[model samples]
Target: MGDLGLFGPGSVTWKVHAEPILMVAGLRALLLQTLHPRALAGVVQNSDFRVRPWHRLETTVTYVVTVNYGTTADAEEAGRKVRYIHSRLRGVDPRTGEEFRLDDPDLLRWVHVVEQESFLDVARRSGVKLTDAEADEYYREQLRAAELVGLDPATVPSSRAEVAEYYESMQPELATTRDTVESMLFMAVPPMPFGLGWTPLRGAYTGVAALALSMLPTWARQRYGLPGLAVADPAASMAARILRAGIMPIPRRLIEGPIYKAAMARARAAGHAI
Candidate 1:
């Protein structure tokens, strides 16, 4: 049998992922993701985030939303497109002087784990409650996305404990590199297209960037020479609440974009209430 789109409205993936705070979580994920030098190289070599940051942002968010919310066929097809893109890309590891494919499983796993952990970390800090079991379930269910990117689901971490262990095992491979700094700066303030540098827009972007940075794991922050302090925890929590409140009033149909709209349509067709 094939996969069902949306994993149904009841899937743990939907429960945690449907929240708006995930947009901020995406920034945190970007920061964590660039810490893996090889992965950073893949991005720096292949992506144009520096020149067209919003395009990169939109593409990242679109792929994620597709994998998590698209129909099984659509999700699989999306995965195939990503795999095809990766298959064509190669990069040299600056640290090791070795060449690598973008689709390398180890690198893929690093990308996968950091993205997952970042989303969960930010959502939980922002007050979307998931019991330990629910959190574990969300992790387990998220393996589909990993598989879509050609990762071996069996080798991927699928629970909170497993995720913790996975990160521990990979610590030796993580670091701060030039690419990491560049990627983080781009993610933090991005760049204003067309010279529109209004104070309110710039201030809000900086605030969100600070919030994302504040949510980083201490070791990750220390690697970047950033201080991840205790005070940031409560501050992040308050900011999270504010963000949640801001997005909560908007209808889901308005904020979630096309992939989500299609997913909700599928859910409705299946007689499921979204």
Candidate 2:
């Protein structure tokens, strides 16, 4: 019965995102984002992402979890923090002489759409049960998320068909740049930090990244010059389930972060059994 933030327990956003496989979706989003030259250029110019990739990822995850499960005030504050950062970032196109703001509506919209698409695709492919209507509802709910990062809500696609159409329309604008190729390779095997690069765990992480790559839509795979395997979707889904099951033995408290723990307390106080 307390404030449930931008999206409550009742929202499809909560339902779809509860899956641990969202970890893969995060990588997939990064892969998809690099396909856009402007977006990639903006990041290459303005971000310290290459040197501190894990730090950048943690920042992104913190904002997403706060928005998804924090109280109203907390969520708004998180959004404000992100918007302010975006407003300060600018980059010049490597291919053209043009300069661009990181928060240019066009760039914002592109990032929002690919990101949400990656979430839904990974969730469904990873064995989350969502009806067509529920899938549509998820996108509808994510429009609020799009708005959080400075996108116009009305400009974003709010259903599967619309998203597909949007992708189709944007295809001509998407091509692999040299930076894109480098980014893909970087993601495939991001160097480990703190001397962990020499550990066997680094090989395990590469296997996880491969599953994320396999789950990309055929068109996206094709764009990257990878084989567009008709069977990759199902194969990735199977792999996701196996991976999810393997992690399930870890006690919930051992892995759930402070944000998740706090959110669950709030939900319990509201009388939700979960």
Candidate 3:
């Protein structure tokens, strides 16, 4: 799952490339939550408005799990652990700022769905190549975990159209005030500290590859003196660049604000709400 580029556009290898690093990060988060639910709860409940500590924590954990253990079974287990910890935490209501249950159904659903989507998108982008049968299997496996989180299995969308509809129906419930989904998107990519263990070599390679790819067209134009060559075969050139450069890492911040907003806008234009 970590190998999947669902996070954003990059080399397919980078998606696979970043998995182990992400997995380690996830394991760290889960271990922290398991050991210190109260501290985690406190962070979730009282962090400053600008800093969403809980969201970051969740993202870290999810990335770790997805990268380390890509199977549905692993995701389900991770979900269960999150729910368990959430059940124990006491927090102020997000909307009302009053004492509230961390295990609130709505909140749980939001978290679970966001994480699930991240993993799914990664899988899709990485060219995991899920056939309808595989998709159905994936859906069924996820359904069991969704049930644990209080989500209705029936609510899970199986087809692209259904996914669009699901996003539409949840639009009202989704926060639009501060691009909450964007936060999820950005956070889904774990920070370096958390990701260091899984694929350090791959991570380094991807970063270098991305940097090289970014400079290739200019290099080609300047060195080879081939004006418009890059433009003429942009797609092929980009592909060649990635192949030559190796895997590249995309920064999470790039995906959150503008990119996410654009996606949301497009989805909305297509009659799907985010």
lDDT of each: 0.84, 0.87, 0.42
Q: Give the candidate number with the greatest TM-score.
A: 2
Superposed model 2: Cα runs more than 4 Å off: none
Error of 2 at 35 (Å): 0.2
Estimate, for each residue in 161-196, the C-alpha lDDT of model 1 and write its tens digit.
999998888889888877788778777777765576
- The local lDDT score (0 to 100) that residue 237 gets in candidate 2 is 86
Clashes of 1: 0
Residue 66, model 2: lDDT of 88
Task: Output the better candidate (1/2) by lDDT.
Answer: 2
lDDT of 2 by residue, 78-196 (tens): 88888998899898887787988998998888898888999998888777888999999999998888888888899999999999999899888788988999999988888787889
Tens digits of lDDT, candidate 3, 13-96: 223323322222232222212212233344445454235444665565554434233344544566677667767877753455
lDDT of 2 at 49: 86
On TM-score, who's better, 1 or 2?
2
Give residue 29's error in model 2 in angstroms: 0.6
Compute the lDDT for candidate 1.
Answer: 0.84
Give the 10-residue window scoring lowest on summed lDDT in candidate 1: 1-10
TM-score of every prediction relative to native: 0.93, 0.96, 0.44
